[model samples]
Target: MTLTQRQARMLADMTTPTPTQHAIQVRGLTKSFKDVEVLRGVDLDVPPGSIYALLGSNGAGKTTTIRILATLLRPDGGTAVVNGHDVTTQAHDVRASISLTGQFAAVDEILTGRENLTLVARLRHLPNPGAIADDMLARFSLTDAGNRRAGTYSGGMRRRLDIAMSLVGNPPIVFLDEPTTGLDPQARLEVWAAVRELAARGTTVLLTTQHLDEAEQLADRIAILHEGRILVDGTLAELKQLLPAATVEYVEKQPTLEDVFLTLVGAPTGAPTPTPAKETR
Candidate 1:
């Protein structure tokens, strides 16, 4: 094609709307820490407004991938685009388009839950920080405990608050790095609800978790990362199809240990019980 014709076609292609666009895209992503390589040619595409779980065992480089996409760490090789901005070149734009919630809750123990939310709001220079905090508290079902010190929050409640804080600016994408780690089964369930709410509200969530069930329950699509490469990527049903079909067998269904534990403790479904009032970080 002539150069002029090629330019016109390119412009037309750019103007045309795609049925769907990836919220996060990684191509041949590679990262190395000193002598030991961490990520080796990882590729992922997370659809907008869906939960994409990156499942892997320990040392699988999940966190490394997240850090690269979040612009917190530079990848040694390859390209990662988050929210349509290249992480390496358009780092500022990428940062503006996403939030990162690490494994642990980053709450200020001394601050009340309300205070913590407002603190993040103010840091982001959002308008009416108090109102924003209140709305977030209500949205995350933390309104009842809004005035309580974060130190007194149960593990699940704290995680909810932490995630709420991340949504202060309404960034289009969020990276949750093992958000349920170290939480009790009840607490994990609590966080799971929050995650569901995020996807429901049109937020793209890229969740990294080692827990197999977490991926099964939360992800619209799952990608298994091992030794820095994605082994398989698909919906739960699609992934399950990789193995041979199960034989026809009838067995009595048994209650899972987690089910019995939650039932025994009388865990509330609406919310997790808070830590004791006397408990402090």
Candidate 2:
């Protein structure tokens, strides 16, 4: 078939790969607080529609990394790109394409669940804020408690609402920084379900978790950070392979006291569980 110049141009455009396609791309990310160098050099690639967990102990630069990616804090060195926009140079554009749900719920205790979402929609200047609020309330199962003040909500409920509010603009990438830190076992499970749902629905989630089990349970890939550097990054099975071969040792199969306690309490160390009056995911 003989094609005109316009047809050839259209075909080329259709086949071209987007230059800014990754959900997140960070190279040699570094940060310094006064004289202390927290993140010496770090690099990461988070693909679209996946859950990537950053695991680290306290002061391991997990929060710093999230802050830089979310455009909340500027990096002293390196580069971070979110949804094809440089976080430093295109801070506004990057922020417009992402949401950051911090360690604590950023809900307004004074407003009801519906009101909170409505306020966010209005702030973003979306069309029909009331409709969006109600729709979000329903989507997160907060319809029943939509009228109740946020202060009356449980820990899990607050966290759900907090996350739901972040989705008001429906950005493709979400940043969760130690989201379940202070929640009870059941509450943690609920949040885990929510995180799973987010990734399943094609939202790229970059979460920082202190608990090893949490990373194993929810992350499609995990990165272990120490002293501002990634010690390892891979799937759980891949990481396990990196460990030395198991040594032969005699051991009982009986559950330990902690195991029994956990089983009886119905809360597995991390990930998520528990029912709230209103669930949000």
Candidate 3:
């Protein structure tokens, strides 16, 4: 069947990543605090319009790496670039092209959800801060509660609003450090969908997470960081290949405790969880 020009263009856009452009590129990136070393030497390459997850345990320098990439912390050694702007020399330019969502939601407690986003918009000098705030509220399913103070918002709503505020400047790269922490499973899925929508719209996401399933769900590529260094980097399949082959081939399926728990809780088996269908404004 022949497709029309519009359909062809849509397909091309969906399938093709922005070539010759990398949202984040790092080489021998190093950082240290006091007498202790945090990041010995780190390297990463995140292409434009893809989700690259950094998986690590605590004190693995994941946050340190993200901070450096977002231009929040200067590295002790090496170089990194975000949106082609050097994190070392062009820190301001790199900051301009990126947004950072840290482990905790950064919202003003006394301000309404709308106000919180509005404040961010104003700070960024975005045109029509009120309109942008309302748009973010609607996009995150918070229009009904936008008038209420952020302190009154649920954890999920606050998290959503935090992410919405990060998008006020329409940055090309976003750094999400444990975005789903402390959320109910459903809320986690919502944020996951939002992250996907960002990538689909040509935004590059660099996420740090401890949740293995999350990495499987949202990341196109993943790197495991340990002791401030990347232990492995590859697609999920490639990582699996590196693991020892399973000797026991199960001809019959057996439900495990996790399956039973999920069944009891009504969790879907790797299905796409429903998310806010509102168009991003």
Candidate 4:
């Protein structure tokens, strides 16, 4: 489908039952550390059950914004509402409504995958922690390795287990901060599939990442952050329109100078370098 069509579909989806309400709402959010201002009057509105992508270059305050929304760090200014609960005024309610998966897997190395999930279930006060653990183990396809210590699992397996643990309470909103950083292409796809499944099941997702293609693939709406401010916020096509129209180049002869440069330096010339894939949902 065309980018315009994709955006139209997203806007239409926002009014549906999937995202029944606004999962996250922010206004004039600003934060500073010492003398440096990291966020400058940031604002965002994420519909429930939709994947919202927060894209930015390094040092652009993407992580800082996610931290504030997740209630991990307090913002210096502005107010945020998650699931109708204000972050500052109703922190407990906000916490109860959201789950966060940070850049690194937070699972315990010594604990088996099942043990880790059981721990989260217990923390969430689930009625049957054992049952919840068993369900997640099968849902994430970790049943075979469920008894193995997390430290022994492959990187992808560990990441999946970490995310499964986060769902113990089944919070309506989830914040994923670079969730697929070091995995191979196949593993990355698996993570993406899992994220999509969650959204399909009516989970709202806020994702922060540097990977433009990932944003294009998953984000119903995309926000670009630059210098601690949102440079653009809209559907993928809207953001792409901020640049030139799509281009197609055909070379009939030999590899071009740009290709030679990329071959020698192992980096693209002039073209935007591909961002390292980091799992954050």
Local accuracy of candidate 4 as per-residue lDDT tens digits, 78-117? 9999999999888899898999998988999999999999
lDDT of all predictions, in order shown? 0.88, 0.85, 0.82, 0.82
Give per-residue CA lDDT, model 1, range 61-135, as digits (tens): 999999999999999889888998999899999999999999999999999999999999899988999999999
Candidates 1 and 3, the one with greater TM-score: 1
Q: Compose the digit string of candidate 2's lDDT tens values, residues 96-176.
A: 999999999999999999999999999999999999999888877689999999999989889989999999979999999
Per-residue CA lDDT of candidate 3, range 1-281, in tens? 56667655544443333456677878888888998799988878788899999999889999999988887889999989889889889888988898999999999989999889889998998899999999888877789999999998878778888999998878989999999999977567668877887888888999999999999999998889999887667677766655456786435445555455445566533335333224332
- Estimate the TM-score of every prediction: 0.88, 0.83, 0.82, 0.81
Looking at model 1, residue 207 earns an lDDT score of: 95
Higher-ranked by lDDT: 1 or 2: 1
Query: In model 4, which regions exceed 4 Å deviation?
Result: 1-20, 247-281
- Candidate achieving the largest TM-score: 1
Give the deviation of candidate 2 from the true structure as CA RMSD: 11.7
**Residue 160 lDDT, candidate 3, scale 0-100:** 84
TM-score of 4: 0.81
Candidate 2 weakest ten by summed lDDT = 272-281
Q: Worst lDDT window (10 residues) for model 1?
A: 272-281
